[model samples]
Target: MGFDADTGRLDVTPESPAYGTKLRWSAPKLIEAANTTVRGANMRTLNVLSPAPGKAGPATAAAAPDPRPTMPVGPVHTRAPASDGYHQALAAHQATRPERHVDPTIAQAIEAQTHALRELSRRAFPDPDPDSIENTRAKRRRDAKATHAQALRRARAERAQRGSTAAGVQAPSDRRTA
Candidate 1:
């Protein structure tokens, strides 16, 4: 569309894209017409993937940048590589390799290590015992009984020494009692 001298509005359409896009109408010197076409193409492809919040239409001026990349877009193209037989020759070449040697001692050691690890894993990491506390309590009780018996023997020996000093006396036979 041409300029509206009375309203001062530049009414634009798609065919007149070469004249200038939305950004050029607002800031004429900001970008060129070729740059605007690439940007338009980028927007079209990008919109196919993650779309805008509301892509039903595009705004004349956006507050944020579009999903379109800041780089130039081009058509996909590839050239058939000139073959020099490099890969084919390498594939046909024979490699000089050696056989794997297994030492009997080292093999036995590895086998033993594997078996030990297997046995360790087969057992529970934390063994569950029904009377774990009872075992500890029994050991403590035995220790206490031995200590009490020793104390009693010492006491009887002291008494006998005192009696022998006054008269003739001997300590009683040791008896384990608890």
Candidate 2:
């Protein structure tokens, strides 16, 4: 019959020449015809399952069923039983040791070492010139820039190789066998 483009509803029995043609069709027949027409149109327009345009080839086979197990099929069982003998021995050993203690001689030696460390640190650190620091930073940035450029060139070469392989695969000879 007629269709409302805005709402997508069909006018099954309207007062028109097209409506007269539809009125004679049984409901089931009309539905079947509509489904067939829609499917054919979709086959032409949607390209939903096509391997490629303008390239005829065998329809792809359905994928093989997965051989791997998707889930555990049987009740799981463990051969080795859990044990705590090692943990118990460790706990008993830790409890027997003294966790806190101090020796006066060691404490005095530690104080002397701290004083020596402070003196060493005072003599070891010299103030850096800002100009030298800036120069070093600039040199590092320049080296990084060069490395980045090299990486970009390498990437381009790799991409070119991949493209060449792709082009080779799509050559006419490759299609001739198919």
Q: Quick one: best lDDT, which candidate?
A: 2
Q: Pick the TM-score winner.
A: 1
How do all models score by TM-score? 0.31, 0.26
lDDT of 1: 0.56
lDDT of candidate 1 over 1-178, digit per residue (tens)? 3444444344444423443344445444332333375453212110011222433434534544597877648755587665669666655563434557999999999999999997887685544565866887899999999999999987886766778767855544563343
- Candidate 2 residue pairs in clash (backbone atoms < 3 Å): none
Scored against the true structure, residue 155 in model 1 reaches a CA lDDT of: 89
Candidate 1 has a TM-score of 0.31
Residue 60, candidate 2: Cα error in Å is: 99
lDDT of 2 by residue, 1-178 (tens): 3454444345443334454545455545665566587763221111112122243334422433566878878978866554699778888999998877779999999999999998888778643568877888999999999999988887876677669778884423332110
Clash number for candidate 2: 0
